[model samples]
Target chain A: MTSDAAPAAPTNPGLGALFVGFLTISIQAFGGVLPWARRVIVERRGWLSPAEFTDMLSLCQFLPGPNMINLAVALGVRFRGIPGAIAAFAGLIGVPMVIVLLLVTLYEGIGPSPAVDDTLGAIAAAAAGLMIATTAKIAEPFFRARDWRAILIAAIGFLAVGIFRWPLLWVLFVLAPLGVAAYWRWRR
Target chain B: MGAYGQLIAHFAVLSLLAVGGVPTVIPEMHRHAVDVAGWLSDTEFTNLFAIAQGAPGPNMTIVTLIGWHVTGLGGALVATAAFCVPCCVLTYFVFQLWNRWRDRPWRVAVQAGLSAVTIGIVAAGALVIAIAADTNLARFAITLATAALAWWTRLNPLWALGAAGVIGALGFA
Candidate 1:
């Protein structure tokens, strides 16, 4: 067998495995899926080495749309092409979509009582706090690098979009290319 | 265009521009959903965001919830598909190309710069949601405490969220 020739060859998971893997990750993801994704894809399945998963994740993050969904599509395609991509995407979204819809339906059924409203409001506040934590976590890398230009750019982005309420499209159109150029010049 | 058509158009554009993730595009989502189209109120939007966060799934559940609120199951399906399909197709095609150019300096610089800006944008989005959600001092304090716990501790965020829910149920907030 070719196994002797290439001892390091990674196992190519079947499409079913791809679906099941993403499904498990989706179900376990309460606040976020990236950690669970790392566990399942790297430690549990051994489908991708830790380094490979990191590399893949970096690429996925750089792409548009949700990072987790992009990772799902990328991993699926890498292993089994388009059909695999479909399987993984479907698995990732299928059950969660149903669950969310059901919750919405339930909310609608319960109507808007004062106590229920207060509970949801409190939950919203906590959820917003989670968003704050997320911001700190993502910003940590910039803090470590002491990249002032990037920091400035980020600040400007926040001011323009978050505070001033400028249209996101216009703000990004101006900021993204400038940010790219600044980094390009510095590195060059 | 109809509401379904508008949902597709709006979310589809947001899909490609969601450089970091869904959170990065949330302020704009709030703008369109709350300010422009008048589809949902600020409180309704925040509630949906909280519900999606508390649920066990991807963060994109907010998008699904919004869709369900506006039109129904069909809207949910369409909104989700519109948000996901364009970007996934782009990812599929670009995966091989990205691998080929992985080591290039231009790619490195782009990643570094965009990621920095993405961080700022995400923070802003978080701030927008925070302002909408934290309407009073007690609620704001809960937000601050939850943020601290999430950032400093290894405990699951679900615990903090659950505690806040109980506090609310007790009529404390």
Candidate 2:
């Protein structure tokens, strides 16, 4: 008597799989994709569990790239290896890229009309507001924690460029290391 | 510099520093483009940055605007692709290796610093946008209100932007 047990099939992610994953990030995202991302990739889709997604997010926070983009690459690798990673990266940047190119063409075609100028100006104002709102909302917690150093950094950095008209790279060159050292001390 | 060289240099530098997005590089770009290269004036660059951000898509499109200023459409493509590719390559390898030591203290410091720098850069960008966009009191008021609305309400940014444009055209600003 002989008993045969079939070996388990390996889950090898392919380029196609990675492409699908890339598409997922783009279409799923609307306003932003932080908390919602966790929902889709982990809770809903089961690509990752909450704990695993959290782990990914934490590492991405430190990395010198867009956190979402970082996550997409990491996740792609998880599914399809390095090729998967490439696919995900391309999908994330490349998809939005086509739109960017088209927009530039249209911008040139529109030339400088009254409507165009006014629309652009209004959008600029709204963008300013967007940045301000982002700052206030994001900085609120840092303030509440009584982390005056970051606040000072923000204020000083702002004034350095906004008022003093110093170059940004110069200000960062002077401030970044000092800020890091000071943060190290403050935490201690 | 020749057009190709300038395009390559600009995008390459932008690629290295494009943490949090292109606005993080705005101040530096402004220094290089407006101050150093004499490519565009402060107001012109600011206006372009604002226009790019205010548009319905990715912020990287401003690279095109800069490209157009320096060397026209071809320049724009070169800068955009140059900026996009290298970063994409680096990101793949970095992410693959991150999990091995994700919790180290150095990692913590890096993230804290990145967010802070992003905040600082974005704040500066806003001020620049304000200066260029608010050519008059009404427009300035619109900018102020936009800021308030964005902070208080969760309204879509595009709608507000459209409304503000109408006001501007009507000479309300």
Per-model root-mean-square deviation over C-alphas: 6.8, 9.6
User: What TM-score, to 2 decimal places, does chain A of model 2 have?
Assistant: 0.55
State the interface C-alpha RMSD of candidate 2: 9.7
**Candidate 1 chain B weakest ten by summed lDDT:** B111-120
The regions of model 1 sitting more than 4 angstroms off are: A1-68, A75-88, B1-79
Per-residue alpha-carbon lDDT of candidate 1 for residues A1-188, written as tens digits (9 for 90 to 100)? 11012224567889999999999988866556765575568645778864466557656766789988999999999889899999999889998999888887787788657887788778778878877876775566567778788789989989998999876657776888888899899897
- For model 2 chain A, give the 10-residue run with minimal summed lDDT: A1-10
Error of 2 at B6 (Å): 7.8
DockQ, per model, reads: 0.46, 0.28
**Pairs with backbone N, CA or C atoms under 3 Å apart (clashes), candidate 2:** B139-B173
Which candidate has the top score in DockQ? 1
| Model 1: docking quality category | acceptable
- Deviation in angstroms for A89 in model 2? 5.1
Q: What is the interface RMSD of each candidate, in Å?
A: 6.5, 9.7
Q: Judged by lDDT against the true structure, how good is candidate 1?
A: 0.80
Error of 1 at B123 (Å): 1.5
Instruction: Kindly provide the TM-score of model 2 when superposed on the true structure, using C-alpha atoms.
Output: 0.64
